[model samples]
Target: MLKNPFLDVEFVPDLMWFIGQFDVYDREETKGAELAVYNPDDECDREKLIVKYGLDLKCLSYRHKFVLVRFLGEKLDDPNFDFQSLFEIGEDCAGSWPRGEWYNLQNPKGFLQDVYVNAKKVWKKDLEKAALEDPSTW
Candidate 1:
C-alpha cells in the first residue's frame, strides 16, 4: 500500500513538460543535433541555459518538482539509460506558459546542477525535504 492519497493521480504536463525542456528531448527529435551544437564549456551558452530553466523553476507543483529534481537528477547521472525509448515528445504539449518547457538547453547536467544550486538557496527546506524523503512515502 502507498502513503500518498493521490498516488493514481498523474502528474502529467508538469512531469513531461519538465523533461521536454532539456537537450535530452532535442537529442531525440533532431537526431542528436542539440548534442552537436551544445557546448557546455562556453560561458554564454551555460548562462543562457541557466536563465532558461531558472525561469520555469517555480512553475512545477511541489510533487512535480521533486519528481523532476530527483528522477531527472538520476537520469542526468546515467549515461546508459535511454528514457527516450520509453517516451516520446509530440505536438500537443500542455501548460499556460508560452514556450511550455521547450528550450533545448545545451547541457542537461549543467542545467540541472545549476538549477539545483540556485533552487537550493531559496527553496532549501522544500528541496531538502523532497531530497531526504523517499518518493514511496509521498
Candidate 2:
C-alpha cells in the first residue's frame, strides 16, 4: 500500500480540497492522459477542461506540496520536484508547470493561487510598514 505523507499535517480546508481533487486525478484510469492531449488557445477553456476532467494529480500535488513547504513553512520529505523556478513568477505573471503542458492556466479557485496572491499582498503591506519604520532594512 502507498503511504500517505500528509497524514499528520494540519491542512487548511482549501488545501484538503485540492488534495481531494488531486486524488481524483490519481485514481482515474487514464492517469490524466485525457488532459495531455488537449491544446486550447484560451487559458480559461483549459481550466474549464481541468475542472471538468482533471489533470495530472501527482503533478498538482507536487505543486501544492511545494507551496506548503516554500510559502507556508511546512516541511516534508522532498519529492524531488524540479519546478521550483516556475513558482517564483511575480503576482501579475502567468506561470507554467510541466505536467500536461497546461500552459498559462491558472484556476482562480486553486489553493496555490490563493496562497500566493494572499502571501504577496501581505508581504507588500508588511514591507511598506517596515520600510517606514526602518529604512535600513530596505
Q: Best by TM-score, which number?
A: 1
How do the residues 1-138 of candidate 2 rate in per-residue lDDT, one tens digit apiece?
112346655333233333233222333446445444544334564444444433223432333433332433231223443223332334565332324333333432243443334434434444344435532221
**Model 2 residue 101 distance off true place after TM-score fit, in angstroms:** 3.0
Native-to-model Cα distance after best TM-score fit, residue 123 in candidate 2, in Å: 27
- TM-score, candidate 1, is 0.43
lDDT of 1 at 69: 60
What lDDT tens digits, residue by residue, belong to model 1 across residues 1-138?
Answer: 122324565453233444334434324446345433544446665455445544255655565555656665666578885543323344574322112223333444555566555545555666667777676765
Candidate 2 regions off by >4 Å? 1-6, 12-29, 53-100, 103-138
* CA-lDDT, candidates in order: 0.48, 0.37
Over 4 Å off in model 1, which ranges?
1-8, 12-16, 19-41, 52-55, 82-122, 131-134
Alpha-carbon deviation at 122 in model 1, angstroms: 5.2
Clashing pairs in 1: none
lDDT assessment of candidate 1: 0.48
